[model samples]
Target chain A: MDLEDLYRILRTGHVQAQGIVDTVPDPMLVLDSALTVQSANRAFFRTFAVDRYDTIGQHLYDLGNGQWDIPELRRLLGEVIPKSSAVIDYKVEHDFPHIGKKIMLLTARTVFNPDNVSHLMLLSIVDITDRSRKEAEFEAVFGELRHRLKNVLGLVRALANQTKAEGVSGEEYRTAFLGRLQAVADANDLALSDHGDDSLDALVARATKPFQTAPETIIVEPSPPLTLASKEIMSLSLLLHELATNAVKYGALSAPAGTVRIRWEVEQGDHPLLRLSWRESGGPPVRKPASTGYGTQLIQFAIAYNLGGNVEQNYRTEGFEAEIVVPLERAARPD
Target chain B: MQKTILIVEDEFIIAMDLKVILERLGWRVLGPVPKVANALRLLEDELPTLALLDVNLGDQLVTPVAEALRSRGVPFAVASAYDKPELIGGAVLAGVPNAGKPTSEWSLLEVLAKLSPP
Candidate 1:
């Protein structure tokens, strides 16, 4: 009723309001009609890395050496708030000296003080830098996947055209085309199945699994555990497929008594190299072909060009042999 | 004389098929080189009437080879799965002909026709 009594009530209300603002989790600020910050919550200081002394009574755009002076932020606070009485999700991206680049979402509402009939703005800031970064990374990964898919499809189209043009019978072309596509599909499946690198033995087994009549017929020599990158796995798998296909038609696997032996070792040095050998024995006496075929070109390309390695195919009188030496760095295993 | 065309693609199957299509069309096919280094070497040793280049060569871009072919005045067309101009460096490939990936034989021939020597 009296002047002193009214003053006490006002002081208590102010303290209560300040305590409530400090308890809020998101950064918040109270600004007068002039757009000068009258009060800030504890979160405001922590989120922006500024002290109350530097923030209070300062223009919102002038805080932290003008790091808060974002063009989008200015439009939201200046035009949007005045017209609409509120703004939601006003995004601002700025490079702050202390915290680097950050993405912030701001929401603001106009509040009127009944006693003075003056308008005040209540602003809240949400730091969305981490979420925005993760979203961008996910988009990039998806884009890469789409690009790779397109390339794979392109390869498939080319394969079909080449097979059809080879003058092979329709059935033969169909079989051969499907076989090549399956090889590609198998490699892709292996790459996506597990995040960890694939073992060399696993790769060989997968490639040769479809061609083998019995496990013991095609001997895979015991070798140390070695892992290969996904790209290397795909190339090597396709390479082995071509080799096994040749063996099935004309090499060791064509005959019951014939045998094929695959062995590999890692030569450790300044740059580690994987030395792999494929040897066939006891087949019909072998002779080098006069002309190169698509299969031969594929093998050479996969090993030499794709793997950044060297491949030598020697058709000895007794059997056929292929030796491959590839750099370890290019085909690194997951540590 | 049959025109000799060189192909520089990283994918083995694609390169092999391109060779077949070109040969069927009565063109002599030269090195379907898969690496930038190999492609550059082949370009220096043998000159083909035209070249078809894949923009991405495994871990490397084919821009340097493109630049080389440009300097030699060798007409070539770029083949890539990437349609985004920026991804393939728009400025570098502004005037170069492009054949989008998954290109049919007809599409490939169309682009090659554009680069055929007069």
Candidate 2:
């Protein structure tokens, strides 16, 4: 072919190559043997927020005020690329200006002409920052789940060891221990359910469901929309379970005419407080025990220790009543 | 000596049970405080012969309490369900005695033996 015809064909081929590289989704750059940028695709400019004027003909290390001058990247290009025809999936983590910290996967391929002389290197960058961040978050959540499971098992063991066996038969002891365990499991299921809905009403309903002989036996008054953290939900579940268990054996739920009314409201003060009341009526006469039992201490500790709340119980001949007042910030999950 | 010991555990049942066990084991028990603030407050006025600390206390870690006890020269051991060091991350807890949870009586005695001198 004549020189003019050959020149036109080479120019057309170069433009077609440029078009194909620009279409690639990942940012790409063509570098000379000296590692200076000869060309960069549209994605390279868009992803790094740089223009062709500053990017073209600039040393790869000098681009964007030396943000790309990463030690790992340097080693990949300087040492690894020289020995191999292509370096694939060279992971580089760096803090880039205006882009924040980024985890990137780079692929560098040596380009050779017909004479088999390598004159250029093709570098493509895939930003895996978001993917890595999501992975880290997933790992944190999994660790938390594992930690919580261990704690639950530990708590169950503690419960078994502490369960009173003085006068109660084996069956009675088993029933008591299993009832408490059921309460804990129910609260956990509600807390960790896919929807993650831990509303006060839902917790009360779940904790009291097993004790409810009929739906009407237990009455829950309409309360404000309040969601609690997982710990708070667990504590509240135990508190409710103890109250219902007592009522079932000795209080309101034991009598057909008996009923328990549960209500809660937020009291606004210097610091907001959640006031929850459990009142029972229509059962046998109620009297305070001479000595506190496991149920009593569990109820007290579940409120005072776990929730940083206050519990006031009054054993009146008419019925048994308890009012719990917890700091609103601890009771309601902060938005 | 009175052989007094401090218990810094958050879980109510565990704390109460530990208190009973320690008492039965013939050691005088101080507050079974659940929060870091409570533990720090108790440390202000009283120093026990030894302490048992739970790694996670509701929302707070036991790092501050560990630091306080360390600075006070009071020996303590960690009680955690998590066995991994990274999971129970804290520079203060490195090489500290760990009494893993669901702790048996023998394990408790072993941890106590490590913290106290004969």
As a TM-score, model 2 comes out at 0.84
Q: What tens digits encode model 2's per-residue C-alpha lDDT throughout A66-139?
A: 97898998899999999999999888888877977888899999988768665899999998899999999999
lDDT by residue for model 1 (A1-335), tens:
99999999999999999999999998999999988999999999998889999999999889888877888888887778878988888888888899888898889999988889788999999899999989999998998888899888997787677554456787887888888788888788777767543778777877888887976668899887788876777778878888988888889888888888999998887788899999999888888899988788778878776667988999997888999898887456423
Chain B of candidate 1 achieves a TM-score of: 0.90
In candidate 2 chain A, where is summed lDDT lowest over 10 consecutive residues?
A326-335
The DockQ values of the predictions, listed in order, are 0.72, 0.75
Q: In candidate 1, what are the lDDT values of residues B1-118, reduced to their tens digit?
A: 7788888888877887777778888999888888788888988788888888888777788888878887898888888877763366545666677788886778887888788745
Assign candidate 1 its CAPRI class: medium
Candidate 1 chain A: 10-residue stretch with minimal lDDT? A326-335
Query: Evaluated with lDDT, which candidate comes out highest?
Result: 2
> What lDDT score goes with residue B54 in model 1?
86
Give the DockQ of candidate 1.
0.72
What are the per-residue Cα lDDT tens digits for candidate 2 across B3-112? 99889898888898899889999999988999889999999999998999898887788888889998999998888877764356578888877888777778899999
Off by over 4 Å in 2: A1-20, A36-39, A52-75, A93-101, A114-118, A165-170, A190-197, A221-230, A287-290, A330-335, B82-89
Q: Pairs clashing in candidate 2?
A: none
